[model samples]
Target chain A: MMELFFKPKSVAVIGASKNPKKDGNIIVNNIINSDFRGEIYPVNPAADEVLGKKAYASLDDIPGEVDLVVIIIPAQMCVQAMEDCARKGVKAVIIESMGFTETGAAGKKIQDRIEAIASKAGIRVMGPNCTGIVSRDIATTFFPIKDVPRGNVVMIGQSGLLAAGMASDIVVNQSLDIHKICSIGNKCDVNENDLLEYFGNDEQTKVIAMYLESIADGGNFVKIARKVTPKKPVILLNGGRSEAGAMAAMSHTGSIASNARIVDAAIRQTGCIRADDFTELKDFAKVFSTQPLPSGNGVAVVTAAGSVGVVVSDLCAEHGLALPRFGAQTIDALKGLFPDFMPPSNPVDLWFAIEKLGMTRALEAALGAPLRDPAVDAAIVLLAGFEYTMNAVEEKVVQRIAKECGKPVIICTLVGYNRLRNRIVEELGRDLPVFTSLISGVKALSKLCEYGIRRHRFGDR
Target chain B: MVEFRPTEIHGLPGFRRRFIRTFSGIPYIDVLSHADNPAMPDSGSENFKIADPPCIENEPMPLNEIVARARRENRTVLTEIESKQILAQAGIDCTETRLARTRAEAVSVSAAFGYPVVLKISSKDITHKSDAGGVKVNLKDAAEVEAAYDGITQSALQRFPRAQIEGISVQPMARPGIEIIMGMTRDRNFGPVLMFGLGGVLVEVLQDVAFGIVPLERSDAAEMIDEIRGKKLLDGYRGQDSVDRSRLENMLLKLSAFVDANPEIAEIDMNPVFARSDGATVVDARIILRELSEAESARPVQS
Candidate 1:
């Protein structure tokens, strides 16, 4: 019954138009451009063809087996079109049109009619006010707004724009893999819980990120998020906090924000790491998708600047991540590299040695000391300038470090001609946490630490 | 005592928003502005004690004047602000409440509070009336709704008292939500410090409650909450709900704060202090601020 989305033999675009700028045309084009391994049929009243695809007068006129009927049309015509999909026995309908439910009284009535029609017909409606779903395997992006990324990061967001923004950032800014990005807008029918349930068993999905404006059903989300987060890291960027949050939730997704504290408490309890910003979402995804989850929060920061260590330790203290004092042995190991007065600590500054011993031993000492210490659970190596050469030793050291201790390592550096940031992700493949900024790197590691602790306590993934 | 006549705003001498924005705006004269109902209980409420050490050295120049002066200086201490000042002086820590009776009061109260305070009217008319104009908090008060206090207090007295009257209250409230009603009810339920959560307004909202025999301790207070039907929300559930029990325990501490502050508080009727990360404050407090006899003051602590 649900075969249309994943194994659809053919799909019909309900509001297909000849105009290139039409939302329906864009959806059709995105599917075609996505190399979707399925047949596409455009349903238009007057046109015989649309975007070089065989156009039918309507869903009933399509004749061929229409597995899924996706609509992007005006509000009034939607009910009749969905009724046609119901009549034609289309298993799934992705309504990418706006104006239903979101616009007040009139739209609410239209939305009610649509919900009733979809429910009775036993057909699932993705949304009445949504941008639809996007997948690398089959992209159904309406508006064709931005580039869809290629990798192993699956996402679900209530806002279509925010989801697209995330996808664009991941594709352009970082080297992280993108698997699936689903925008269940308005969520009239399908919501976060459904996606969580789906992604819970999704083998291909290594890490999943979500931006929930609000949860439609708190219980269902809690159940699904709990089950999924432990298995694989599910990073989230949830908004609608304040009355203590939960005010914006009404307009954004028609979700009750619950109490913001309750939401945070619930999400954190489920063993899911809630990202503070978009950068961490991709950063954590890039790191966790490839790197091993750190066993503990005890992190070591090895940077050329003392300020960097301060920044790292401050984050550690706040996030419940530990940055314990380095042992005499760990400090002594760095004594030769640093000035006499600058005694070594958890955030061991190597400004003294980088000029003398150069990258080889500085990088070695940075990775080696933290990896061996029983107290230092993880490492965040900060290197400035275009330092690809640093990665050579960093990678070699991390290889042994990861094997002996299951601690994650991150690198925050200024990427130059060598594209130092890019090379690290490619080499590690989620073997270590790598971020471009100090804040992001620390946050990602902190989240990994949080997930590690919460999962252990909850007795799940 | 009866000589303190109520002050009235004649003809709504409208305050110029533009004047507030202007640099040369001299506020020595009364710049007219509309007012509103309160979000919380009155500052002069029985529980909102003058915790600050008495202005023995510095004259207590009628705090309304001090508050008014502070408003011009952009550093006024409103009733709730002064309450906190009083509490700070007395070393009696209560839930942090921010007041906003008028723009000056709210600004003065907010200046004292960083973030997250019970935003309410400090009114005399309706003491227990939170739903009315007499009380409103958790609101971002920069929007300036002063008339709300009078509106609520008036609404309350008209609905309940009818003939009697009182002004408003704006308190920097705390959420000593793990409440055990420390007073005798006007109803048949008399004198037991009747702990309620599973039944009262809080339990209806938060869904956790209990009943203690009397003289609630941190433990007894904790135990009373065990009587709640929605104990799950209080107790840690599956990524669901959490109650900062320490905060609930602090309500007992606040009971201690009140009991410790004065010999009065013969019957404390503080219904709600919406629970947050921090401890509780008396949002809708109504203590019979009775003058104590020497013998009663000399009585041993109720431990």
Candidate 2:
């Protein structure tokens, strides 16, 4: 059922147009540029051809069976087009056109009519007001996101612009890997529950991140999430957690936000990780999608500066991730790499080692000590302004630490230069999660440990 | 009909049961823990006999009938005695309260309850007794009880002239312990959600609470208790005695069961649930039943 929307063999662009910059034209162009394996048939009565493909007058004119339909026309005309798609036996439809439910009563009536027509024909609709979806097999959205990073995280967002923003960040920054992006705007037909059920079983999706203003069905979502979370981590960032924010969310998406504490408890009850902000969403997505879950809440911090170590240690404690006191053997091993006068600790400050032992060896020892320690469950390596010698922080060392210790390592860099930041990010991000700030890195590790503790509590893994 | 099968999860501690119930064509699987089946009618557990059981025989009427009577009388709020009665019938520990309509009755009830009894004006209309000067706690003797009764009744009448005065309720003053609040409010989406917090007079000022959906399991109750910001206060903060956590967990489970069983119960405020080292007891309970519409009675409660 979900494959019809994601990997359809044949899709019909209902409002396909020849005019450049139009939603109908852009959607067809996206499918063409995205290397979608499916056959695209343009259906526009006014145009003879759209983006070098012959345009049919209507869905009836298309000879092949349509697996999916993208309705990009006016809201008032959506009902008729849906009926036509139903007649054509299209199983999935993505309505990118706005002015439904979000516009109040008159629009809601039309949206309800569309739902009735589609449900009677047994067709699943993505949205009456949405940005549509993007998959690795095919990108069906009109939102112009270029060179999308295809990885394991499936993002299901309620807001179209928020989905676009997250996709653009993943694509442009190349930080997080998003396997599937579905903008479930208005949720006239398909809601979070349906998408969660589908992607929960999706093998390609390792992590599921959602940006929801208000959940359509809270009880069922929690039920499905409780089942899905044990297998795959589901991280959600709720938009309307405050009263004023809730009011704004209502005006924006026409959704009444559930109480924050109630929603928080429910989210926790389902064993889903809650992201405090969009940055934390990306942070958690990067770690959860990439790194393995830590066995316990014990975190080891390795930093170049003692001040950075202090702040991150405090954050670790705040987020329930403990910085364990180093044992004699672990302290002895760490002290062997550092000066005799300076005793070794959990943080393992490498300020002197960077100058004495060079960046590569210093990083290797500082990170490897905690990673190799049996007392530590996870490791956080902090690097500051090592732009030129980023390769010195060997990927092999990080990978070896992960493989041997059966733990995850996170790196947070405090580089001021953008070129160096991007270089370090592109270099080390492939092996370990490279965070821009200390708090995000610590919090992400804390979140990973939280999932670890919860999964262990449920005896899932 | 459904059959229960014993299932063993490898390397796990508890005994698990898989119950498959099919309604229409959809099959629902419920994983239940069968650890420690609570023995009925005195299994020799601490104070189990003293607790009021569920109104099993139904001669004195069930909660639904009491709610229906209140609805017929056009009363939205239940009196303290009626509220605690409903709670006690659900097997929850509530303060032993007696409603006295006259001065003599108040003095006699206070004497029977022993010294250091608390007096509060009992009226269906006056929800906040403290604000209306209707509460007089720690009344030691019969003379003090008489004066408290006069003051409470006079103040309640002065506050709301049109309100009907039910009389004063006398309860033995509970020992000082950690104050916690257990409550339920009907959420628009998720029916009744239970809330736990560090409570008492400062509950409003503190506003530290954690909520959970009803029909909570033992693990759910444990997590709810640990989720609160002031959770450490329950563990004997600043030289105070630690609360009985298992007893608190049992209270939460009872609240969940009560909330789940009574669909007409719209809101329940069990404030100042005095938590001592031995067990927790409900000091004040307020249960408000659904009075919006007759149509609500047919609506299936969401779990």
Against the reference, the lDDT scores of all candidates come to 0.58, 0.76
lDDT per residue for candidate 2 within A387-431, as digits (tens), equals: 534557544556666667678888888865777677667767876
Cα RMSD of all models vs. native, in order, equals 17.5, 13.6
Q: Write candidate 1's Cα lDDT for B248-292 as tens digits.
A: 665554554444444322334444444434443444433333333
DockQ (C-alpha) of model 1? Answer: 0.02
TM-score of chain B of each: 0.49, 0.75
Residue lDDT tens for model 1, A314-386: 8778777887777777777777777777776667777677777776667677668766788877788875544
Which residue pairs clash within candidate 2? none
Model 1 regions more than 4 Å off: A1-3, A17-19, A143-150, A172-174, A242-259, A326-344, A386-405, A414-436, A459-461, B1-160, B163-303
- Model 2 misplaced stretches (Cα beyond 4 Å): A146-149, A244-258, A391-405, B1-60, B111-116, B174-176, B236-241, B291-303
- What TM-score results for chain B when candidate 1 is compared with the true chain B? 0.49
